[model samples]
Target: MFTSAAMFFNGAEEAVEFQCPVQETGLTATIEELMSLLQEGNSNSNSGSPNSGSEGSNGRGVYSLDERKRRRMTSNRESARRSRWRKKRHLEDLTEEANRLKMENRELKNRLGLVAQKCYVTWRENERLESESLALWARLSDLNQVLVAMQTMRSQY
Candidate 1:
């Protein structure tokens, strides 16, 4: 089934990831296509003419099981290292964003407290001015009563 995939594709999908599957002969078509491309690429890359080792009549070099296992282990280790580095970078970014938000929140609370204090001071000043105005009006009324009494006594005389 994998060999048949070479007919539909030009063997350049090795770097691509597989997601959905298309069913043909009850087999996942994308997996078959990916495997075919990867195998072709591997065969092409390893086809260098080797003078130190025997080359088969098919122009391909023979590979040992130990060499294949070593390559697989190396690839796995590199992949794991990169994955760890990415996770660490992501955590650092999140921590920095949280710190910035906390600083902004603190500044806003301080400004709110200052505004509330100013409002209370203005209210107290207005209340003091209102009481002073009432006291002045009462004194003026008492002076008017004394003037009226003096005018009445002069008229009696």
Candidate 2:
């Protein structure tokens, strides 16, 4: 009946190990579970035995009320500190991402402006070419008419 009690502190990979002398105790739990059980036992002992006050021993150890409260407060403070650090890191990540995106957007906008200018220049050139082509066609038509007139005069003579 080998029971393992693994207690992780602050999300660390290392665990606190505790060995029990009794083989059939069969107690496999974490530190949190042990703490909850102790608290429950403390409450029950206080309720059942009115003589047991804040400093009463619960056969395990002499964990006074003040000591338990202090430990709980310390744990809570550590948890809060870790939470704040995580939040700060998350905010920093978001800020960095926003700056990166802004830079990309600025670059894209500059590229779009350059492309629009090129398109405008090409459109102007196309219009100019079309106008020149129409003018050349008109000139060619006039030349053809003059040639026909000269041919008709020669035939009359």
Candidate maximizing lDDT = 2
Q: Which residue pairs does candidate 2 place in steric collision?
A: none
Return the lDDT, model 2, position 69. 81
Candidate 1 lDDT tens digits, 1-157: 2233332111232233334334557557656767677767655544443322323446544444555567779999999999999999999998999999899999999999899899899899889988988898888888888889999989999
User: Which residue pairs collide, candidate 1?
Assistant: none
- Per-residue lDDT over 1-157 for candidate 2, one digit per residue giving the tens place of the 0 to 100 score: 5543433221122233555333454343454467557555644444433232433334343344655688889999999999999999999999999999999999999999999999999999999999999999999999999999999999999
Give the alpha-carbon lDDT of every model. Answer: 0.65, 0.67
Candidate 1 local lDDT, residue 30? 59
| Model 1 ranges off by over 4 Å | 1-65, 140-157
User: What TM-score does each of the candidates earn?
Assistant: 0.45, 0.57
